[model samples]
Target: MWRIDFFLDNGYENVSMNDIVKHAGGSLATLYKHFGNKEQLFIYILEQKSEEVFGEWGRKSVCYEGRIEEFLTETGRMFLDLVTTPDAILFHRLLISIGYINDSRLNKTQIQNLMSVPVIIIANYLENEKVNGHIEVEDTYLVAEQFLNAVKGPFLFQTILGIQIDISEETRLKALKQVVTIFCRGLHVIQ
Candidate 1:
């Protein structure tokens, strides 16, 4: 999987199956048996990468039980940081290009499942807070969405539409912290 990322990051797009197999020191027959074709191989690599990325977040969220607002603010910044990395941004651009090329194979539900990791984590944190009387959320999902929207403007624009705005680390952290603080204030029980 790392080999695939390396090749793709190194500008090997639109290459043939033969090239991939040769580059990876494997045979055509083995490549065909394992991945079928170039598209399949690329999607397979993406699937593997998505799982590795989202799975790590899931694992950390499971063990997390800190202040819900602070936790979400930090986690949101981390998520944006991951998405903004060069390799990650390139992966998204490749997917968008593929989607534009009449190939919806990359949009399979299984692959799409990887994207819901943050939503799940935020919902979990909000629900936990509600349960513990730390905050009040009538609808966890919607609150999660609102919280996301608050910290979403910069990275979401860049990821979805190639908006080339530079977001500094300090600015990103401040934005996330403000969103979480606002969310907490909005939903907290005032005495």
Candidate 2:
């Protein structure tokens, strides 16, 4: 956790394994043995954060109960809350930097795993709904991708670019509500 915090405070290249060992109170050999190297440590941190944000997302069962709009709106709100946090923003920026800088540290598989977790979760939920006649989705995976993009589109780029990092609660709720409304309308959840 300290290593992750250090990485977030300092950029990827700025932080070193020595710094991590110092702040985290661990031996270099232990870190090396566990993570294999600094880059691997960073990747592990990303994995932990991704799990923290998107893990057990569907644990609290969605109660459709004839109010699909409510479910969609709540899910959209959760997605926004998870992705728009300061830490999440920082994590994504680090990911982008690693990607563009040609850092082979973050392998393609790790990148896909980081992104695919939520997509898989949402797609599975949609698949179940389609099966039960709650909604008619021809391709649940594509719809899930579209839904995530729609929710994150308004804020991710601005925050990642540092154009506007902070989002007020009122604005956040309003935007999420609008996204949810449009998503429901598109899916014909409400007519």
The residue pairs found clashing in candidate 2 are none
lDDT of 2 at 141: 90
Error of 1 at 43 (Å): 4.0
Residue-level lDDT of model 1, residues 55-133, one tens digit each, is 6766676455646655786678877788767776776665556557664444456445555556777788768767767
Error of 2 at 176 (Å): 1.5
Candidate 2 C-alpha lDDT tens digits along 1-191: 55477877887778888988888996999989999988788778778877776776666435554566776677778888878888889878876776777645657687777788787877777777777777776898998898889888889889989995447777878888887778667776623
Ten-residue stretch with the least lDDT total in model 2: 58-67
RMSD of each: 3.4, 2.4
In model 1, where do residues sit more than 4 Å from their true spots? Answer: 1-13, 37-40, 159-164, 189-191
> What TM-scores do the predictions have?
0.76, 0.86
Deviation from truth (RMSD, Å), model 2:
2.4
